[model samples]
Target: MTTARPAPPRPTTAALKVPYRRPALLERIGEHPAGIVAACWVLLLAILCLLAPVIAPYGYNDQDLGNVLAGPSAAHWLGTDPLGRDILSRLLYGGTDAFVGIVQVTLVAVLVGLPTGIAAGYLKGAFDAVSSRLADIILALPSLIILLLLFAIDPSARTAAMITLGLLFSPSLFRIARAMSLQASQELYVRFAEVSRVRKGLIMLRHILPTALPPVVVNLSLMAAFALIIQSGLAFLNFGVLPPQASWGGMLQDAQMVISEAAWMMVPPAVAIGSLVVCFITIGDAARDIVAAATTPRRRSRRGESLEVSVGSVDAEESIVVAPSPTALLRVRGLGLSRAASGTEPAAPLVTDLGFELQPGESIGIVGESGCGKSVTTLALLGLLPANITVDRGEVVFDGEDLTTASKSRMQQLRGRRIGYVSQDPMVGLDPCYRVSNQMIETIRRHSDLSKSAASERAIELLRSVQLHEPERVMSRYPHELSGGMAQRVCIALALAGDPDVLIADEPTTSLDVTVQHGILQLLEQIKRDKGLSLILITHDLNIVPALCDKLLVLYAGDVVEHGPTLDVVTRPRHPYTRRLLDCGLHGVERGEPFPLIEGTVPHPGTWPDGCRFRARCGLATAACAEPGARAVRRDGAVIARCITVREGASEAAALVGAVRTIARPVSVIGDDPNAEEADRG
Candidate 1:
């Protein structure tokens, strides 16, 4: 009897709840010994501020004329101040006032800095320019003069003076927030969220803010301490608090007045100021360390919704006869996409009129030099293009559904469920903050009706499938802890979590060493055979395609220059660009003598020629080749090339790429060397 079909998988990037998670910021800060001690010191100061009235022997302004300037005793602990007030009482009250002022400064600074910095980073234009300049002006102003001017306006305007000081100090935090936001905005994970259909607000909260906060905290802590120190200096100069109302700065001013007669009076406020500053500095250092060790996963456990998905199976369709070329798993017809026009910038076509077909159990390679839209096309397929780029005109039909018109939710469901993607750099494929087990298990559980334990088991199976032995140990490690090959294996395992029908490997072996490259290719080949899944491989290397790909599409300037059977295209390349890639070698400009690859670089977008983009570089380019329709040439119901020399399967073009095949070239990258380590299960 025929078996039933499996249930639909859960969203890959959607709703991954950790069985237990670290309270991201606190876990990093609280676990460190230095951080704990620093935090405790700050807490102790807060406690003293809160309980000042209950703990003090007398009120801040209460004077005992009989105990004037008295020494420490049962009646007057820590002696009496110049006004004959209980010095201990005044000190405790000063702590409270100082905390209040510090809080006021910090709150105002953060309020001014965070929004401006985050806005400037995310929204770059006139706003960024204006805000950045405004911050520069603020930073350049004489901060003490500004505070004194505020005091001059109103002698008792304590709040106004503190607010002005806070405003002046904001630029330091602004700079840190802006730098961090700028860097975090460019991270691969943030970009991944964009393409994954994650809401823009959530992207800021989850990815952008997390990275920006640590440094922001560090700068803010130091800024607070600086504010306190400046306030103390101003008070020492007789500019603040106006006496009676106790403040640390005011107390220091009093101590300075009687320093010769009662030197011990100066010690208390001085020690308080110095110790609090030290605590802030220590806390800031701890936060900086947290930022430096970002790869270390937070260990503080948190309760969250269970990510385990519970899917139900349905009966499978009756078996039917399969057609040959008619069963295209994915079809692209006249696919066009481009970047949106912004301000004076006009829209630039990224990938235009791109068409391809993939059958089950088939591999197609999209090859070209850098900037040829090979990667862009794949991003378009998964609805993962950047904010600037949009799908203008295209029909992406996958398993009968038109993906171009699919809802963001539907598109998200399609990603990693039916269509899996592996990026160029394996290191960027995973989030730096999570361990392999956490990421993999979350993905597995989210896509299937499996508990954490069961999902972990599935993850181990996937690791084994990807040729990564010791899956248990590897899963427990973070992304930085893994080697290049191991990370790539983990990435592949992640792609397989949802049991996708198609896998798109985008230059998987770009930076990988020789042995690793060949083994990864062999592993991919093994996967294709075992899973019977279609593959879309994007690469710039002409030599590597034959190892796993059956069909080839040579892209140039977002146009399909040449495409056909891999053997036919590589052996008898119909385009000059394809032939040049074979001639120049892979390194490009580094091979010496004849020089590797093509001499000139790929033309930038919007600067491409009206007819053929390669016309400027092609040796055989003529007037006829510059015609309007010269960019693409038709051959037997397929696009053969965009060149005048449209020869099908010619031996002349084959010799350029084929000669390297007979030699020892394959043993490293494409060839199967017997001594190399092979997958055990395969």
Candidate 2:
């Protein structure tokens, strides 16, 4: 008998099947007017510097004695200085010198100070203490006094001025770098990187450095402007750029001597200095504003109507395709990690023996309390953990590659292109100064070889796919212009830009409103159905599990208390901890009554119980439970309970009933009888 081979396992309807596309940079920049203006100004300045020689009519240092102190005229525009030098020539030359000082100082500061500060801040203890003390000492010293003294000792005033400025500015750079690095060093991503065995240098350069540099760049601009002013000030004081050498500051000094006769000299040089400083300040302020805006939580747009589009209409049935086989996708085994300083005593693990698998088109929910290691687990998967943690053992196999042992370059290639992450905080994830479209295009360009026009078309299409309204207009708008919900949608579009196989979403809806949350969830569900994408959803809200996830892993105090099908876990939790969690939820409680709350806080890793991890809070705990090292007990099918007395049915039931009764009883009447009160009254 010829049996048809099991209908060739029908393709999943859930997998998304659209063609991959990316957005263009121009399309993205076009959305934000402020970004456009900043770009133009920067471009203009760069061009001026590049073509300075051709643009200037006379040599920057050349003096024309025939037109000394001449006012604005055809032959000597903006007049000439005391030495008969073209004022315009001096301004151009002085600008070049100033630009050189700014660049040199800034480069030196970032290279010398940034790493030292990050190391001092992140390592702390001896390193931080020494750095902090040194910074303080530097701050205490009189900067100008030292400069004047150095100038008195040294014949070259310019050398003294530059050295003094560099030394004076080093302290501030150290302070800013230390603060930013300290903050980043504590993030969950950094912790993940540590556990993933990522090299220290890579972590500093790739993760910490990128996040740290933007602020440094802003600071650098301010410092550069300050440097120019200082140098010019010293020159005016007659301790800088001595003799025939003319600087804007020295010109000001000479103009003061002949103010009544040659007022034009003072005005032109002063205006030149003022204009350059203003430009630097404007650029710095704009950059700071952009970064701040990017990091700020977006407000929902009040003007737009809520647009709800069906998921099926965008792609034709023929274009929609099926996902690959589940076994052929990624598989994780015995993955565990922890954050503890190792000593003679064995360190307790934060994530103990955690293991799970993802089919090509399946979505799994990781539900847990805060500090339960849900975020850490996800970070480990993506090789993005912190520096203090260590991954003891784990094997992550994806598409024939063992990611656990994959090199940094390989991991990077996989991150945005093969695997995408939608971080919990959209505000922090996006760059604020950029238009939503521009950010989307950047991701596309980073991963794909598509042309500008093609990438842009793809970006617009992706935005439309994510159900963004007026995709073109939204693409042109800055991140500040979009609402929280809209920004999140754009984030989703970016995640989809690379057409990744696995998407890790860490609390994607935490910052969104109820309406927007529901919308985002619906959109995610729709995308999952369409793409057959594998998902690892890290969330605290258990309600989302039944609807969004097929399987659930319940984490408590860094341990997996329960694991099974989402329906079974939610309906009939075998572990006492899981049961208690469900009982404490809003759905398990009586309507209008205060929901039940878990009794005690999750113990810190070092302080976890010697017996069962949950025994201290478990109502069914007995003398046996108190005995060291509890073991797992298998019940029906794959359900495993960590309790020691599953067979002691009567005692366990009595204990559970008593615990429930204790919770149900009112505190005001505990150990006090209503009959006794009545008798006392009588």
Candidate 3:
């Protein structure tokens, strides 16, 4: 007779009650000189521009013949222009116009160009080709000529020039946006967003757009400087402002006639234009430096403080609770994804007829070799696949909503709220420029209607909940200042900020040291128990699955070959891919024993065979195995194997099991060599 196992202990309330601490943005600002300086300069300029009307003594274009060409004096500081206008007054007024024009033009360009570029880059092929051609045509036209032509026809030259500038600059913006979007689209975070049932727009805005912003922002700054120069150039050419409109460019145009006689006329406005341009360039340079520093990888000293905090107490005897009568939280049925081929042959399907069901609070581990469609499957679920391939036939149902047809806004609402994600590379997943506190706060505020104080408090609590030490201090630090382990923990905290029901962790601890990896896994386990959160853990390492996952899915060449309870799959894998993966985990070996390796590389979908996707790699393949459909064998509960042969002799099965088990034992050192024997004797 079999005895049933005891139920797992409920997570203690004390472990769930994490104390809140306020985030200190000021502390982070103090540490970053470049960011502080750039911010200060921008703030100062904004204030000055706002107060320009109040501070100036006369109208920007006010004239006085008596003060014409006057040198520096108490009433006319820095001297008067040839037109007798107060140089100081004109400079102040000019700044206001420049600021307005720069802001308006840049906003228009970014608003229009960013979306267009992101769309073109992310959705390549015909769309990309058309957009690229259009961008090329627009870029080829001379912006000045277009502005002049529009201004001649329309009286509102300012608007005409602004529009012309936007049209001219948009192509460059699109190119940069597209390039950055393409790069970010490949990131695991983007993949995580896709798999998390997040909408494309939210992923574009929160994940892809933010990651794409660094380069775009850098370009934007340069463009602001360019916009100002272009405005001045237009004014100088007599195309910008008509007479009686005192712009710096207009002043410069008039000063050219009297330069030799009244050199002071040319000096003042020239200096003003040069100084403003210098300020923008300086600010841009500093911003570029800050962005670079933020993205730069730092060598974290081992002596720095560790972020891990112990759970109040861990009960070793606590058995994990496997939810009974589990209901599906996520379901993927008849899913297929494929990329179009170049040659005459039919397009290749990357994922074909893949299906899976995730129950609430269940930890499902996805294990596979590289390029086995594990990541691709997750991406397709999230609607984050690359533009080339299409989701041929499938439905991803989450909380009764079919995710495949979910709108961008709906997906955004679900992401970071109902579903959170932790990626393999935390650094890529995180925004480097943001402090840990800010990132956590943003994540919380994105989904919840929390006040700043409340969001900050929650952010700190999440940092502590993730077992991070010095939670307050860590909150004040940027991503670059934190260690790899610390950053990953911060990422976990960010994911947890929204109190999501499901957390999809894609190799969350891949780059961490062994000790940190174990601690992180423990934190995940502790959190799962406390929150009753479900997890879909995507990992190549099977060693981690036994400790963290209850169910396992083995994928090869984008198909689910074997799936069952974690223990059962690990102990007795029926699929060839599963057997190879298990064999790879066994370390001990006799001298001269042949080390096993999976024979062929994963077949590229473009050249994939018509039969079983894995038949090429299977040693047990026969003529019958070349059939179109997979043979399903059902075992205990829902355990299923999609193989042709599952009725092997008991002895044969035991021999295979014993072979792997013998190799699983650790090797002992023997006194074979003289040096070993001498050392032993000593």
Candidate 4:
């Protein structure tokens, strides 16, 4: 029997003539009208400055005593300065100094600030504290006063002024860079890189720097404008450049004396300053918009007319399971995650007194609006949270092992082997540089005793299992080559490499088009059934839960406000928050009208309400709702909703609570008690 050999790895997307293309810088700038205008102004001024000698009618300093302080005339258009030099010529020549000085100062500042600030942010502690304090002290000193003082100490220290100004300006850059760095440091990719033990420098350069660049680039453009203003101001005060050489500020200073007789003298320099400043500011704004667009994760436009819940077996468990069953594959109790106080900020909780249980083959959907700790809860469970975010009060017992106390090595062993994770964005989840098969093979090899060839075959097999046509062709393609749906499929395959029992998908369908989202969701459902994998789906949209989750966990400001079966919770929401979410969906929407939305936003950490987290937005909130440690009330002897009115079975509350219990009894209710295991067992 002849064995058919696997097809050789197909040509990559690059070789297949589907080369990735990015718009050229000029083209990108031209897309925005403001950027085009600013660019034209900058280019016009730059060309005029560069070719001043060739374009100007006369030398900048050429003195014609006969026509000093002359107004606009045929001989000297834009009029002559007090020195009889052509004003147009002087203006063109003067730009050279301003442009050169600002460029030099900006370059110096960025060079000094970028590394220092990034370092301070990533390597937080004594170095960061000391550097931040020093920067604060430096920024406190007045720039004009400092420049004047430096010039007073030594008049010939003109170059010293440039260096001093650059140094002085660096503190601002440092602050901006540091702020961007801090934000970038918190990015999922950066934290993931740290967990993977990727080199620190590589993490900062590859992951942190790219995300941080947008803000820094915007600041740099604005800083250039500020530099010009300051440079001109100093020159106006005679602290910058010496005469015979005409600077824009010096021209302004000279023109001020003769303004009464020769008003034209001030026009050229004043217009130059004003026009350039406006151009810089405009360009900065345009650049900011461009950078923001480029850096932000693009959400593919939804193609479907409407996004309705996908109904299937995952929507509701058919098996009659009682509450607090002993068959939980993963159990979490008092799972609190927090970030320590920094500077003036108080200790903030990301996940407070959270608890949940995932039964074998059960799919639980953690639904809430953004910032309700759904993602944090996932990270806390997997031991993948950032360094600063501590598991303050939690025990994540998975497969009978408490992961909170697990060593780094032990957690790493379990992460990809027993528990898999699919991140929000597939583009970030898979390294762009590596081919699809390369990442998969590496992952397979990491946890399994598979050789290179076996691992390669295994990767191909995995890709095929995920329903990719021509798996060999896809194996050689990079992340960017695949569409969002295809990339997410690849991520799913990677997550399943170890045949993990539980899959944690964090917004798996986010940023995907509606059609693609349906496909991905269908794929997840298929995989869960085939592999018998328990899934923890974290998403904000309520519609997504009913299709893929057996149970629903409704979170509000880090608190589980309601927990029950997905179908039960959706059809008859016990809590006002749960009902509000359901109302935001298509169920309550009128044809061709705006859908009703939840009124207030989720409360931020450290600002959660005293009693129930959702009380601030709850219409039924009363004086009793303001008290802390609000207890969960059992409704229909199953579903848990944390509300005093619901607990008391008030007349108004009956309408909402009664509707919920009419559908189905809750399989289990995740409650507010820190000792949630004991509470559930009761």
Candidate 5:
């Protein structure tokens, strides 16, 4: 309901269209050719290294004194090192150690740095001050000097040295995670989640962590290369893996010693280390590109482009706009819409001629099925219709001021301050970019003279008034943090921020479960009783009318087919469409008893039949209804019926409803089975 529904006539619609999609992991990875090739090579290298013991031609320690310095041959494919060890075997075995060390170092850095940085950035205050200083100190320490000290103390400290190296690498990761976390924390999505009542850890995992992961992944890849280089440097200096173990750095040292004697010796280890490092960096770049490509395109369809009905007569629903009460709190006189022509699409009326009155402290439900103009009518009152839809004729008079012709500044003054709005979805309604406290308090202060502190208290009071628990706790949470019911309540509280006289809720309970819907209805009823606030509710649910609305307006195909007192209308609806709406509503039927239903969907805009708009679906539609000018004829003061049969000649007490059996009739679509419904339910 966030988007305005198209009323008849030329309503606005979007001009451009684009599809949105998120590519899968393998698909994203395979998209980059060089990245895929690099990934394959890295995978192959790891597999060969892990299987070194079972597949290598000879043991890394099996010396071939006779083949020493020999080129590729049967005895040794990659010649021999200075110690006469097989170069190929050494290379394979050495990779196992390099692979394990790189993974270990990278994991340690990510585990330690990412979380700490996130905590410092998000939790701030004392934790921020302390962690930031600690990271700075760690960065300041000489990494090489500390490792040398450990190596001097124990030469076989390979595991200890790599662990120390990971620690040394962590500060840089910490800085990156911290900066990214800081930026992510300020995002509206993040604040709405936490300030509205979400867990800090969940916020970190769902929002802040995801935001920082891509860059952190690239950093981690580079860190892996750094570890390999550091491991090679350490082993070259004889401080890496001891003689019994194969180390790439130690192998490189062996190759360097014999380089002048056998220059080919340096090639194997040099290529291995360099190639693996390049693979990691390339994969990192691929990851960044994949994410960028997946997230860029956005979709926004024009809500005014309504579904069309294939079959229709030469004309549409006859235009009608009823008069309004001059002294009412708000009077909507002939509010109609027509979509402007665009491209090849012709100008057409979707919703035309709607008029209603709202008295002080009264609740009026604009009842209708989907596509019946309920939502768009509400949007029209707010002057929030889509760009392609224009108000062809109407005057939304609010307390003597015509809002339809009101300036932007004038409308802004009345919107949130004098006329609060609760949208269909509470989560989307709340501007969560700012923290809950800040957003609520600011809105409260905007229309009032309350101080910041007082406004903050008022925000909590508003939440409590809406029956939300721990209002204070909710103020610190984000949108995703709140439950469905909680989200609705949060929306209600925010709408009440300005303490406006009128509250316009558009299908507020549409997405809620039965229990939650009842709770919301009760809350609204209580609010009206306590505050004397006039409520203009837009809904498809008729059951809510008597409980909340003092008056009712039954709309169909963008026309008000019935408008009268809630009790008078719901108890005995005059229009056939309104009667069908009540019959299709929830009833106290036992199991196996079929629930009533309307056979066909609402006709598309500009496609209603010549006479009555509901005639196409009405079971009692007579040939007389086909006449073009059969609009609503007044029955009682503001009470009217669009059905021609109930015109000037009808008695005031004459039953407006057709026989109940007519409403319970079977599907009338050309091929639909009349018994299909009873069979399914039975």
Candidate 6:
């Protein structure tokens, strides 16, 4: 009989929460006063322009000599011009010239500029240099003279003028696009795609364009505002969009003829032109600010309902009801981090169902290959993750306080004061321009109530503790001046500056040589023992785990395959992945012998088979292993292996049949290899 499945645990923040009413319209208006005001004005003008025919009392060109030079009256409001046309009617219809001309010019500019700029930027060399020189020449020429020359050739040619104006605008757009693309091309993902022989057009469209387009879009808005003023000015000079069309400039030209007799004629059209122009300008400014805000880094809000607040209550009446485990100094339960989905792709889990605990002075090594969410997990713990990534559902209890639902201020207080982080690349982590002491002292001052001199002394003391030669000299030196080993040592010293309780070292020795790596690891071990600090060492090299970590957490394809005592897991691994990793390690291999390799690569995100994430690469795959949920066999206290095949033993004949059916990549398995075992039981 099939047993019913248990429901998933509710997120701590979402479990206990009340629904909040949406913000009122006035509250929203108060929050962004300038933006709302500008938006309203633009919206009002657009409505007037769209409904001009219905709103206007009379036709734009209607003439009545009986009311010539009439003042503001019931018959003809705002008086009649020299030609006896209603000024209000003309003012209402005048928006068409300003709106349509700017729209056409901007459209042509984008179509001509966007692709050409992206191509030049991504595929740089002779083409880019030639385009740059041509753009420079065009930009250097006087814009008005250029327009006059075009008008001379075909006077009254509105379409030709717009096309020429668009061509003039292309160079600036091209420059912005090229600059943005150059920066985007250097990203690791773009380089990887290029190495994989992806099409050039696809790379430009997918990778480079998204990053480049925002600034270009902001420029487009500003350009529209500027184009409107230029279009109206040209119309006044009788060189832009023609007379009898109710253009702003044509109205102004007509008003000038009756300036003395009917000064009121120009008031309506002048006010209309100025107000509309100001609205467009305001809109452009607002658009630019929005782009800036979206690009800047800020603390991400919790997207879903919160589960619970901190276990440690601020009030005396609400004391902790559920006591934390004796061994748990830091406990992470149901930890799942994911980037919110965009466009066509669904929300992809970077790391999911991740749970672990760390005791004071205990080191747990998070082992995984690159791109397996090793660094992402560490970032999530410290709340330093990028804007797109967030803690989807989890509870991080540090010293009885729940961090998942903590405010930004609380997270900031905990980050450098209670927790310290050391990254993979020391050079990237350290600023190049500033001397090491400036950065260290600033950090110390920011976190602690130490004077400048006191912070400097603390920095020097920490440097000396890290075994750096001449602490003062090292502090004075810039990051670029230091060697790889020296830079890493300085980084360790900086992490120690705050006197933090928990120290997280994320692949600290990855970039160094063997000797240097050994030194760094030794330093970490020494520091941990001296300070009695809780250390979380994240690395892919399993060899270091036996020496550094007390507990081993083996991660494969973002799934923890096996976790137990470091020595026991290393000597005799139960999971297929854990065993395979041991077989591939260089520990037992002699100088002449080749190391063992797994059959296939780890599956990409969203590509793994259901039930077992490792089933594709596991040699012990069977029909039972392909079932829905992950199965775990408990070995000892908090020690388990997630493998269905391990729990149910199979006969030799059955193993052979299972292997034939579930081979991810076909290869002959030699019987002589003693390590070759069938997909079988625990």
For each candidate, give its TM-score against the true structure: 0.56, 0.51, 0.50, 0.54, 0.51, 0.64
Off by over 4 Å in 2: 1-328, 340-348, 588-592, 633-635, 645-682
Clashes of each: 4, 22, 4, 1, 33, 10
Candidate 6, residue 431: the lDDT equals 96
| lDDT at position 550, candidate 2 | 81
lDDT of 3 by residue, 315-350 (tens): 222211123223789877667777764211235567
Quote the lDDT for 353 in model 6: 57
State each model's CA lDDT, in order: 0.75, 0.69, 0.71, 0.76, 0.77, 0.72
Write one digit per residue (lDDT tens) for candidate 5, span 1-682: 1231222332122222222223356766666889889889999999999999999999989887877788877778888877678989999999998998898898888888999999888888998898889889989999888998998999888788888888888988898989989998998999899878999999988788877777888898899888999888888888868775787888877778778999998899999999999999998888766655454342323544432232221223333444556558988877777777542233567676787788899989999999899888888888788888888877888899888888888888988888999999887787766667777888899889999889989999998999988999989987777888998988888888888889999999988997688788878888999999999988887766676788889989887888888777765667888878877755435569898789988865645555577887888888766554455344644467677555333444444332222222211111146564464344
Better of 3 and 5 by lDDT: 5
Higher TM-score: candidate 4 or 6? 6
Error of 3 at 457 (Å): 1.3
Predicted candidate 4 versus true structure: per-residue lDDT over 1-682, tens digit per residue: 2232222222121111111234345655666787778879988998899789899999989988898888888998888877788888888898988888878878888888887888888878998999999899989989889989988988657667877878888888788778878888987888898999999888778766666676777778888888889889888888767687878998998989987887778888888888888888788778776776566553332343221111111101111223454678998866767878632234667775666789889999999999899888888888888877898765788888899999999998998899999998998889988898889999999989999999999999999898889999999899889999899999999999998999999999888986687778878888998989999999988766776799888988877778878776666677888878766754323469987888878766655545567776888887766544243334433466666544433354655554443221221121223553343334
Give the clashing residue pairs of candidate 1, or none.
22-300, 571-654, 584-597, 666-671
TM-score for predicted model 3 compared with the true structure: 0.50
lDDT of 6 by residue, 209-325 (tens): 877776787778777776777777788888866767787778888888879987877787788767666766665555554544444343333455332211111121111122357
The whole-model C-alpha lDDT of candidate 3 against the native structure comes to 0.71
lDDT score of residue 18 within candidate 3: 23
Identify the leading candidate in terms of TM-score: 6
lDDT agreement of model 4 with the native:
0.76
Model 6, runs deviating above 4 Å: 1-175, 178-182, 185-214, 229-239, 246-324, 588-608, 636-638, 647-682
Point out the higher-scoring one by lDDT: 4 or 5: 5
Q: How far does residue 495 in candidate 6 sit from its true spot (Å)?
A: 1.0
